[model samples]
Target: MIGFARTVRLWFDPREIRQEGVTPDYRFSLANERTFLAWLRTALALIGGGFAVDQFLPGLRWGWRVGLALALLAAGVVCSLRAVNHWVRCERAMRRGEDLPVSRFPALLSLAVAVVAVAMVVVVLVGWEG
Candidate 1:
């Protein structure tokens, strides 16, 4: 099962193979793979954020600490799932020679970042002692 999924993922991974001719499908698949990796990085950052906040602000109340953890975990999960979904859709589109779908990830990620920033500001201003 994992191998099958990896095969499908590879079919869409632009960096996986380089053909002689640079077709539209190939270009889009490559873009898709780049996007997937970007999302994976975003997810990792979110997970790191959870740990950072917990460790750096040990004085935070349990409620705020838990909230931060939950927010970070949720962001990671969302980003990871979106990456997989985008890869699958891009693969399908390439296979069918159809136009790739428009991505709303930039907007979503921006909003998430803003939210995180606000949370961080609040934590520092209201909670942190030094």
Candidate 2:
């Protein structure tokens, strides 16, 4: 368990974590933590939604259901990875007194979810037996 914890910490940021040049404002750090948690929650929800669609949406075509599940699962993976990278970048910027980095992940996530929504609409209008 101790080793696992260490691994998780390193996963969050290997090089810059406590290569912390200095501690910045605690409020900024707290805000960063909250943002990370929010992204994590969103990722979890996407994963759960994918599972629910796979399990509960019996009227959907098999191909349509699988496609939706795959898309949501893929998006969740992308969100999780982006969350870690974002946390690392934000923490590094804070420690160095530099501008925080921006990520295109938010736009990527939006686009992905929008595409999934449109696909779902088409699926509903098409071969859905119910």
Candidate 3:
């Protein structure tokens, strides 16, 4: 889709973002960058958790192991993409003097993580050896 392609392009094209409106306050931009970095850190943690689940849980049944690992990996991928997209949107909004864009991603991501935690608890209690 055109929208998806444009989003991908934005990730690599800083000039496109800079072209939008005037430069925002340095402090606001720095804050946005910090938030972006935090999202990236969270993504890296999720990715690492996925790898750990796959590599360290050899005793886990193949189905559960693959499913849980894949879920975490997918979440990490989404979070990374979202981090860039959100950064770009927020930057543009600030430059244009518009209210910062809002997203439901944080709530959705939280709910997803909670679901994963519950699943993990079930898996642990059920015992991999069984």
Candidate with best TM-score: 3
Report, for every candidate in turn, its global Cα lDDT versus the true structure.
0.77, 0.83, 0.91
lDDT of 1 by residue, 1-130 (tens): 9956865676567665333223454676788789889889989999898888778878887788878877888888888887887776676667666787788887988898788879878987898653
Candidate 2's residue-wise lDDT over 20-72, tens digit each?
A: 67888899899999999999999999999899879988899788899899989
Tell me each candidate's TM-score.
Answer: 0.72, 0.84, 0.91
lDDT of 3 by residue, 93-127 (tens): 89999999889999999998999889988996796
Lowest lDDT 10-residue stretch of candidate 3: 121-130
| Candidate 2 regions with alpha-carbon error over 4 angstroms | 1-16
> Which 10-residue window of candidate 1 scores lowest in summed lDDT?
16-25
> Ranking under TM-score, best-scoring first?
3, 2, 1
Which of candidates 2 and 3 is the stronger one according to lDDT?
Answer: 3
Clashing pairs in 2: none
